[model samples]
Target: MKKKRSIISLCLSALFSLMLLFTSFVKPVNAAPTITLEQTFTATANPDVVGKWSEVERLRVNDTNITQELFITDNEHKTSTIVKGFGNDASPNSQLFLLHKFAGWNTATKPYPVLFVHGAGSDGDFAVDPERNGTTPGLAQSLAADGYAVFAITFAHPHGDNYIQREVLAAAIQRIKDITGKTKVDLIAHSKGNMSSRMYVSDVKKSWGTAFRNDVRRYIQLGAPNGGIDYTFRNTWAAWGIMATGAFGPVPYTYMTIYGWPTDTAYHSIYSAADGGGAYPGQAQMLARWDNVYDLDIFEQDWYTTYYGGWGYYSYSEGIDYAINQGGNLINTLKNTPVKSTVQLATLAGSENVINGVVMEDDGPSDGVVFIASATMTDPMISGGATLLEKKVLPINHVQLAYDPTALTWIKTQLSR
Candidate 1:
């Protein structure tokens, strides 16, 4: 009986080994790895970003077999060459500027192109490369990678004058329309750039004589001083503190600008020569125009009226009061402007401590330079003209507002919308 049992066990073991061998030779199929979606901002980045602002069919990034190449254009003009990439400032005409265009743009998926407008004393690169240290990828690069046609403009004079900035920006807008072959483009402006964009939107059809106004879809403003920054004239000590540190100095001039002045003095000197040798750009006499955009107080009142030999000068408050009275028309304009929902308008403002790390007014809170109240668009022309979509308040300083990750993420979400 024992011998018979051993034989049976041996036979069973051989049968199991044979079955294992047969299964191994047959080969098993491996399933494809689950594709992971990366979130560019808060949530995971979706390849099928449909029902967004894009007019074209949603894209499947992995479906395409053809490799996408990034192209930088260098279109030559009669005087200067309009090129792609950063650090180019060899334009023959001062007004003629070049914009950095990111290649590998998946227009099929993301159709509407984004045009970034930098703020006062700042250029296009300020949005893409806010730090100026060149260590991290700018917002432009990130947007481009996400499949949107990204373009950045560096004005000849970011802080020169509103009218001139508007003209240059209009030209840039037309150029963008021409290049992308899109009827409209989206604007993401910062600081003084917001002023230029607002002026452009308010008058692009009249000025450019194109459907440029209709072409604009989204007007996203970051740290926009739509009501004008009161701290410029309100807090003298803080203003001087920021000025002494050269906050509005050379690095910005050299970064994304083609015809920017190396120093404030240099620009002021040139302006003085041009202004019939009157005053520097800082003290450059502003024409009395009660607009929601400009610091109207500077023009409406006589700030230099109380200049004594030893008593010094003190008339900012008086000037402010007079300016307020003169700004009645502007106030009326802001309040009465009918809501024309052609372009979607969104504003992002920042507030916290001033540059000196001290909180002065408990009114609302400021992003050092411009107050939160001013940054968020409250004027009628803007809030009424365009469809007011989003008004977010970020906790950051003025200069750092553009570079903040939360602000950038919020911008991305708005663009998606």
Candidate 2:
């Protein structure tokens, strides 16, 4: 009997050994990599210098350098270059700044820290904390002065891919949570910044992206083109304006025949799938026709040919519809995918169509650039699961939404709740 028992115990020990060996060979699935912290420093805004980080006041910001391993791919999403930060020419992979006001603060009245995401062609420092010597304070400064910890992220490319920007935003939220010892943070995204923030909140991401971990408390969007926009396509002259200034991304129209410039068909053409999908994936993703609802501005030169597609007197265009197709119709994707039910959502739209003195988007109610309907469109979010805290329309233009006193007051009111 003793001999038989010994043999049975030996068999059990061998089975246990096999189990251990098998488990060692299997890797964990969908595990997030540790976000590396490069360094942390206090940044002071230099008023004399006119550039990215020089806009914000020195006393209000404590900048931290953080890195996220990103799969940087071309416009087509084919081949990827593994980058430590947002890998692009605008800002290097090493200099992705996460600006916050936590270290300098003495107390906290708010439960969660506010994370600010800037719009297209803008950085966090300039977007939230612009250099304005006036009685009115920017959103970031107001929030911080009221005893709330504020944080903002600056992307490598101001007009970088939303797919990559979404991942960058997720990393920023994680870093903020870690520093504050909080479970969640409040998110405030403006203009194009809303695209990445919404993508992160809805878990609507590329296959490489991490799922939404329910880390946001209040998701507030200011002057967001939530339903998407077709400003460049609708206003063909605007495309020229962009190309002339070398600001923003590539427009659908080519300036070859009109300006005697060589044709960059790959970058300028709507059909070209060359450079990471096209010269500007971020701008392309926000393409959608509002012409069906609002009349195209007839005042502009060659509005007919620009809208329909063909050689205009000035330039050539593939039309807005073709541009939307080339853009991958990202608006439809976001419309289908809803944010998690736990997050409370809010939207603020600018009703005033006149920006500075120019009447823009006159056919429809717009904040100069974005339509009110597009900005206030939250039915999809509410229907999916998120509770709508509020949807407000302020008498301000697109640019003033971030700095106007009234808008700032409304934002403060929402954050207080």
Candidate 3:
């Protein structure tokens, strides 16, 4: 009887050991619920082009920086709205794309409001994950799920001129103020959005005096072409064609003076006194017929064109043409933009990144659109003598920089502060 009892006890111990091993091998399931949306606006697949330009092929849900652990499902929290801009000649594209928590400004539990300004060629919806596979969500939507008052801006034209875009953004800011009852909101700008935001804070806000100053608390610049990019010149013909059509608007003049390669009209390489007083060796000229331009107004009434050796000469012609045909006042409106932000500033640079479809030669470690140095605002000139509260340089490309996990984490941390 004693032998039989001991054998039974041994059998029970063996069973317990097997159960422990099985449990140890099994991975724990995530406790957080996967969020599903009633509607999703993901980027469409680019059928015409190759190399991941399309919405379907480019960004991956798993590739995003957001982790399942931090993900939360909130059907009642996500909402979108279309706010019309105050532009006198505004088109349908002037409407701002707004996405936020359904509770919106009325929610007492949410933190400060955040405004996201998208880059050129895209609107506020750019942050939204086009892949509705339940794993990927838009940046603004994610922030909303995280219990924050987040708003995004999309213009009527989608590719509207920067001046017009700026006006639209100004109106958007006022709307955000009205809805949230918050006096000031934080800004997260990408690409040309950075220039747009900077123009508003440095120049446009001055027009409003103290009210504008009080309206902005923090500004985050991601992959900003603050120092300008040579990509425009590298593809000279396309650049010329786009300029002639006034696709990018008068802001190109400003970009030329700030960051263009030193080249005179007729595409001859020259020594530029503006670019840290150094000569670019083996710099390819953009246009053979391009000549030195006179009366280039980068700043208001200040015709300084010696920068980049005379790169302005070529760009100024485009600006002049834009001013003459499309709208001269537009060119005048974008000149000599001063830089000053009353709020705290942070910069994130995507370095060593390239896109699948782009063809322009990289000047340095760039995110396939803007260089890392430009995104970081390391140039003393573009930084406007203001010190950045934080700066990060990451190895990521232009399109995904804002959505990158590293960027989102830092942004979350900063917003918490």
Best by lDDT: 2
Better of 1 and 3 by TM-score: 1
Name the runs in model 2 displaced over 4 angstroms. Answer: 1-29, 44-89, 94-97, 102-106, 131-136, 256-277, 357-359
* Model 1 agreement with the true structure over 1-417: per-residue lDDT tens digits: 999999999999999999999998985642211222211111123212211212111111121211221111111111121211112332222243435454543353587988888765455555555675656557776677677888776654434444445555666666667757888888988776775577666652222222234667888887776655443333333333333443431110101111332223222121233322211121122212222433323322122231110111322122332333332323223334433468788888877645445324233466765667666645565554577778888777777666667877888888898
lDDT of 2 by residue, 1-417 (tens): 999999999999999999999999996454443566543433352322222222222111112322322222222121011121122133344225444443333356778888889887666654444543333457777777788877777666556668777877887788778867889999999899999999988988776566899999899999998888877767666566555554444566754343665454335443435432344657778878887888887877678777778887767777777777766788988888888898999899998878753337666888988989999989987777798888999998887888788888888888877
lDDT of 2 at 193: 94
| Cα error, candidate 3, residue 161 (Å) | 2.6
Tell me which of candidates 1 and 2 scores higher on TM-score: 2
TM-score of each: 0.59, 0.78, 0.53
Report every candidate's CA lDDT. 0.49, 0.68, 0.47
Cα lDDT of model 3 overall? 0.47
User: Which runs in model 1 stand beyond 4 Å of their true positions?
Assistant: 1-94, 106-108, 204-212, 238-340, 354-364, 382-385
